[model samples]
Target: MTQEEATRLIGGIYDSIFDTITKAAPGGKPLMAPATTVLSLAKPSIAITPKDFRNPWTPGNPTAAGIQPALNTAALVDDAIKLSGLYTQSGVGISEVYGQVMDSVHIKTQAPNPANDKQLDDAFNVLNRKVEQTDPETGEKTTKTVESTLLTDYNTNMIAYNMAQAVYTAAYLEAQKTQTGRATWPMLAPNYQVPVKIAYDKWRSNFADKVEQAQSIMQTSSQNALSKAFKYAKDVFESYGVTLENVDKAMSRKIYRSTLLPSDWYSLT
Candidate 1:
């Protein structure tokens, strides 16, 4: 099989599983679109916004229906990458799947604390000292006093605060996951839970045998495609009197060089 064929197969299987799990509501309206347009290691980057982290799972919350499927999509995509051995070969890891998690939910940037900012400002004002400076270019000494330490102190404080804020933001986002799927708990008309649960039970009853088999076929076909491409590229370069050594030099050059190695060429080709 070719790479294109493998990609199509993977997408088809994913669509089948997704559609089964997220069957339409009673009115023939879909709860939401699929989590993604495509499923691939090189899928488009997901944009994570602030709202995702805070959306409530309460009944009638429109956003909640998509959350579980989005998370599951990320997991399945990551599984596909691992099974295909692409992550190992490309230096990409399962962490890429985490992008889907973050994207599916909203996370607000931590708001700056005015009191903390004031305290930091006050501390810097008291601790900062003046220093005498000379012009290095002219080798001329001057009686100029500068608040050099003050700027440095302020920057250091900012860095510390930013790090703390990052930690807080990550924690908040993680907490949101605990509430996933709760939106369907109220069991309103066509509550997503009943159909989704029924579908999942049916799918898992066979241990997801179909998806597993398709993924296995994809892995072999993708690997074979890569090998064929690699040989073609090697042949083209050899015809131009370019050796592997030349390719290595091109890859390693400081300027006008590729960030990829020859192995990466296999995937790109």
Candidate 2:
């Protein structure tokens, strides 16, 4: 399928899934309007913030939900480039995913603790170190140093980073099985952004908490298949929108099956 179709399918799924899951709550509402309204990844919404497992006060962590509004909608749109860099867009192996975990751990553990790290550490470091000013009315001269707010990765959290990689790998592998080398994930969509993120965080949590239990919920015949199908989906589409089901149907009705150079167990096309 084309990128637009892929995007739409994911969006529809998000819109539907959120509608369903939120309904189970006492009085949850749709986080975003719909796909048509919030049109592109360039303007995706942070409808629901995932729980930041690592930082507990960052975007990926649900507990840190309050921190998101600091960006506002305009800043959210502006920060797309920085946000996208959180994960490896391309597919990777278990070792790579593990490495991602380690990388995040290292970043979060930075000494002086990250934030623009704005302070010039050099003994002779200076940013307007010598400031001078003259009070015209008082005819007095004064000089002082100006300090700059150090900017570190504002949303730095090892858990979020590693979880992002896990989500990326799952989405990429699923795309490989379902749509060639496509990287058009609904998580990257505007309307579907929240639901997709929630789904990913849930998957990550489930995997972390109870891995063997994945087979029952994911419906994969084998543990390996569960890994390739991108882990956990028991009934995401069946419960909400039929977008995923439709993708499979489209593959079956239109695209002919063929042997792949290096096929994963879950893929036969």
Candidate 3:
């Protein structure tokens, strides 16, 4: 299932189960009641035994599984629920008694599969590095961090990479169109005769700018790798007495469009 659906399903299941348990308890208040204070005065209790709650095959498995996992999944959820009076009788709200619970759950819930882990990991790595940069005007640090494992999944990573490729391809194509049929001078010869030297210089400057912008979209490592490959190509072209400028002109003339889909990256052998 999609990540949003999975999150909502898990969240809904937990809320439903919590509602039922609270209603059946002797002095338990409705789970949705707003508290006068953030901290609850009464301790809460679990209606079901821990073992039954943890088991996968039990009839109460879905509800129990939801609650048990949530206890350790997030601090806000666990802290609020555990500190309430739901678990006790003196002042029943919800469980206010605190205790350690299992931090992970193993159930049959359908969610994004484990195969997408590598994709999620790579995406986070890129985002982490990107976040460390300082904003130029404000000098304030800006970051966008997401903790979901599904973010690194094949689907998401592919989306990011494809976006980068599309931007790169568009810029490169525009550069190529502008550079078409441009004459090249062998050197800065004193006797060089060109009709419009200033125009040539302007075109060259714009081409450089576009290339730089395209390269900037990539992460540092990816940019470095591509630069290294291009350098190798440059050296080979130089062996034929081709200048670096001429080589860049030739390479930019070729348009490269990626045809690979995201699913192709994750296809099993």
How do all models score by TM-score? 0.18, 0.14, 0.13
Give the whole-model CA lDDT for all candidates, comma-separated: 0.44, 0.38, 0.39
Q: What is the model-wide C-alpha lDDT for candidate 1?
A: 0.44
Q: Which scores better on TM-score, 2 or 3?
A: 2
Look at candidate 1 and give me any clashing residue pairs: 52-105, 52-106, 53-106
What shift in Å separates residue 141 of candidate 2 from its native position after superposition? 0.4
lDDT of 3 by residue, 110-176 (tens): 4563554444445445433332558899998867555333323433444545565565455445545
Point out the higher-scoring one by lDDT: 2 or 3: 3
Error of 1 at 40 (Å): 37
Model 1 residue 77 lDDT score: 34
RMSD of each: 27.3, 28.9, 29.6
Residue 9 error for model 1, in Å? 46
Model 1, span 1-269: residue lDDT tens: 99999989977876776576566867785545655433233344444443333332222443545344333333333432434312223444344343344334443344576765554554444444455568999987766434444344444554555565565455545545666534433343244334444544544443344334443443444324455455565455334331122246657311111122332222322
For model 3, the stretches where C-alpha displacement exceeds 4 angstroms are: 1-152, 180-269
Among the numbered candidates, top TM-score falls to 1
Model 2 CA lDDT for position 67:
31
Cα deviation at 175, candidate 1, in Å, is 1.5
Better of 1 and 2 by TM-score: 1
